[model samples]
Target: MNAWICNSSDGSLISFYLMGMPFLPKSLFLPVFFIFLILYLFVITGNSLILVAVVIDSNLLKPMYFFLTNLLVLDILFTTTTIPRMLSYFLLGDQILSFPACFLQMYLFHGLSCGEAFILVVMAYDRYEAICHPLHYTVRMTPQVNIKLAAGAWLAALLIPIPAVVQSSQMAFGTMTQVVNFFCDHLAVVQASCSDSTFQTFLGFCCAMTVSFLPLLLVVLSYAHILVSILKINSKEGRSKAFSICTSHLLVVGTYYTSIIVAYVAYRADLPVDFHIMGNVVFAILTPVANPLIYTLRNKDVKAVISKFMSHWSRGYP
Candidate 1:
């Protein structure tokens, strides 16, 4: 009886229950748990490596790398907020959450998530400056400016979710205790509340559109200019070199935006529970997994830094 209301019989509005991926078959538990355990390790290791590489490698300390480091930190935090609890659900069947903790989790997860969206835009702006306004790139995107931008992204994202959290905190809980998705995700919590969620839904919709989708649109607009600038390069090699830098970021942005959109749709629409659960998993789990790999594979500098670190480690061990 994971349901937590003052009176479950009438199901008024006191508490709620969590139905974390309820449709997941028992037969898939061990496999899914094992997979997520490995996935979590990969996320931590991968994102940590990106952060460390940017920190230790002086040559990698461009304005873009500054943003990359921030992105890595957000990725680490974003995955950390959800993945372990998901793992616990698979291994130990612990989906129960107190009202406070549940809402808190929702806040943190969406806050970090929204932070990542803005960081991606900042990263796009970094490239835009380097590509379009090469002469002023340094003057414009100085270390101090980069710090301010990163701080702004975090502050803006964290604050945007506050209204949702505050409203939900005051709302009465109805009979709908079971959250459809795993972990206490933002929309999941709001949808499960027995009380009317119109205000919060509108708030979240506006936030997603303005905070998330707007940044994505800016990224696309920036890259459109970048592509035009790259095409103007007379030498094919120069154009190729310039375009190569954006591929990883574009790929990451594509994956993240697509995952979130699909996931959100699944959650909102009358879709199957499996699609909803897997949709959450896609953006939450796979994006972190793909991020470091995309950067390391597509960018020579990251690969070089990784190789250097690995070589040093091997030498010490040898």
Candidate 2:
């Protein structure tokens, strides 16, 4: 809870220039703004519908939907932290974000992202229990148990980014407050710090990788077990059906991790800053949309329940 000391009057510790696509010509700003706005709308609307459908459809009351509901909320919040302010910058051309606001944005973005990773790992466990240990799935994934898992994910996400944010907040900026990135990302923000942020940057990187990929490792392990079990099934139909349940989730996971890898690689490489920003913007906007889209198209159970829910809602609409 650091107080913002961005004294615009003194002009010393003022706002930082969020370098959003420096080469992007002014003429294309409107088009780009609308594009991002539409994608943001899609992210919000699509995730919201899935959230509502899961809540209303009694068929979806299982542990899978319980975890999905948490995912949707995380997706919504993840973008909600940055998109509005970004849209404002696009609309008003005010790319200057106060120091405190920038840090808050960074904290929320990293925290929610870490939380989503953890949730996906938990979902992998859910799928493992359902497919590999069906007889014990009931006892393993009770509603109360799912609630606890979701709560733990949220708590961990909220708490894990604190050290990073605190260190960033305490950093002193030099006369040059212009950050060469769209938002106050960890790398971009630290670059502008006047202090020796080597330790802070290292800590953030280690924690981020650990938080993001440790769960990914668990997901892979769970899926490996799932694959073994599926292969062991004697009936072809049983194998197909069992594998189907995992496909949608695997697709979403692939896209999510691919985006993460690409963005990190682009950011770390000596490529143009535009490349890095575009990689982050495109994927960040697309991730929330990915989950609901995959769920709707790949998961028969979700589509069936959603279709039924839509029909019922339409009939009741004035």
For each candidate, the alpha-carbon lDDT, in order, equals: 0.82, 0.83
TM match of model 1 to true structure: 0.92
- How many times do residue backbones clash in model 2? 0
* Tens digits of per-residue lDDT for model 1, 1-318: 225552333323334455666777888998999999998999899989878878999999898888988888888898999888888888898766767677788899889989989999999999999988899888999889999999999999899888878777666664447787778776676667656677777877777778778988999999999999998999999998889888888998987888888877877889888888788888787778889999888889999998898899889942
TM-score of each: 0.92, 0.92
Clashing pairs in 1: 13-173, 174-194
Worst 10 contiguous positions by lDDT, candidate 2: 1-10
Best by TM-score: 2
Write the residue-wise lDDT of candidate 2 on 129-166 in tens digits. Answer: 99999999999899889999999989998999988888
